[model samples]
Target: MSETHNDPLARVMRRYLRRSGIIHLPVVYSTEEPVVFTQPVSDNVLGSFCSVTGTGGLFLAARVIRDLVDPDKDGREKK
Candidate 1:
């Protein structure tokens, strides 16, 4: 690629990765409830965010756990 041609190091790494059969694609994150997290997962696409930060990851985890705890669509907490 033209971009890689400019940098020999990048070009080498790209070639190596290709030969290694590794997917090097930009990771895209998605969610319905305010997706505030994002991360780079090698070259393959991830359905959910592979957070690299503690805060965002923790928040997302907490949200999922909390939602699972209730499992109610009417915003009612489980007793």
Candidate 2:
């Protein structure tokens, strides 16, 4: 019944929140502020991946750049 209820993005967001069990009504959301890198990215930090569950999982990000994850090489780091 409100003007914003007619917005397409508002409708989509409401549906997603409902499906995801966040809320049954419209809620306020905001985008995070853009970050400006103060330091140059190093190769050591570039290809690393982190665990989504934060525990109890294999860490492959650190092994990627070092070529340690190769299945044909029997998971040995390339020299």
Candidate 3:
């Protein structure tokens, strides 16, 4: 299978977590927003959907990293 056919976010997350010495816990993102696409279900899961839809991939990454870096501070307060 092609690299893009696989879950890039999951792969990146796995590599990052492994490097950070977090091997046991699996990360999950709750996607509450609706997606407009007509791809196969498996191809439409997780980051695949975001890539295909050109959606909030960067925003999600930034938000997650921001939360990790300065979680106690509300992000909106800076705006």
Candidate 4:
């Protein structure tokens, strides 16, 4: 999959992350074809799992990096 930096959504996400003081980690945005398995699986369950594993993982990683950078400072204003 090719990386997309010009996407509007990516720009918005990057802006938000910067505002939240998550500047250390690089923000990478990419698109890929959805890999669906034709099994006896409910759509809701698969969707939830992908959402958590994909979006949740980014936030979790960002939090960890931000804490490691400067745990005491609030991530609102830049220093």
Candidate 5:
């Protein structure tokens, strides 16, 4: 048996991965280059929101903001 097979943490992680149905290991790499954005964010961008219920709340807020900013896209006029 390999050294990894004998490791307790490795065995546990492998079991967890198998139970989670993850067939392939993730590839991770490090880069020294500075990050660059393709497009700058607009000044009209909405401020971040903290939600108790996670992504669902954030998605709802985004939908409402989109409608408010461009109601014509949704075929409605802003009040």
Candidate 6:
């Protein structure tokens, strides 16, 4: 098994998504590059909730701040 296969955050996220009935995407990781995973919502209810609540924007801002402060931690770049 690869080292990233045992990543705690990845494992927790996978479990949570599974329990919530979210479709899981392939896990990609790299030490020299950033990894991004995108998932499509198969249910209209969840999609509507996400759009109405503006959860995506909130998540984007949080991620931007996280990356700006510590780019290496989350493998994201600061804008």
* lDDT on C-alpha atoms for all candidate structures: 0.51, 0.45, 0.56, 0.62, 0.54, 0.55
Candidate number with greatest lDDT: 4
Which prediction has the highest TM-score against the true structure? 4
Provide backbone clash counts, one per model. Answer: 2, 1, 0, 0, 0, 0
Task: Put down candidate 3 lDDT per residue, 38-66, tens digits, no spaces.
Answer: 86677546745546444456655776788
Q: Over the stretch 1-79, how does candidate 2's per-residue lDDT look in tens digits?
A: 1223435676676677767887433222223333456999767763323543333133444444335555354343488
Q: Is candidate 4 or candidate 6 better by TM-score?
A: 4
Q: TM-score winner between 1 and 6, please give it.
A: 6
| Cα lDDT tens digits for candidate 4, 5-70 | 546766677677778877654343445545667887765674445765688578668867897999
Q: Model 5 scores what on Cα lDDT?
A: 0.54
TM-score for every candidate vs. truth?
0.26, 0.26, 0.30, 0.32, 0.27, 0.30
Provide the lDDT at 9 for model 5.
56
Q: Tell me the tens digit of each residue's lDDT in model 5 across 6-64.
A: 34556677688788887545221122333445899779765433453466566567767
Which pairs, if any, clash in model 3?
none
Where model 5 places Cα greater than 4 Å from the true spot, the runs are: 1-52, 75-79
lDDT of 4 at 70: 95
TM-score of 3: 0.30
For all predictions, the C-alpha RMSD in Å is 16.5, 17.9, 10.3, 9.0, 18.4, 14.9
Error of 6 at 68 (Å): 0.2
Ranking by lDDT: 4, 3, 6, 5, 1, 2
Q: Candidate 1, which ten residues in sequence have the lowest lDDT sum?
A: 25-34
Count clashing pairs, candidate 5: 0
Clashing pairs in 1: 24-43, 25-43
Candidate 4: worst-modelled 10 consecutive residues by lDDT: 25-34
**Where does candidate 6 clash, by residue pair?**
none
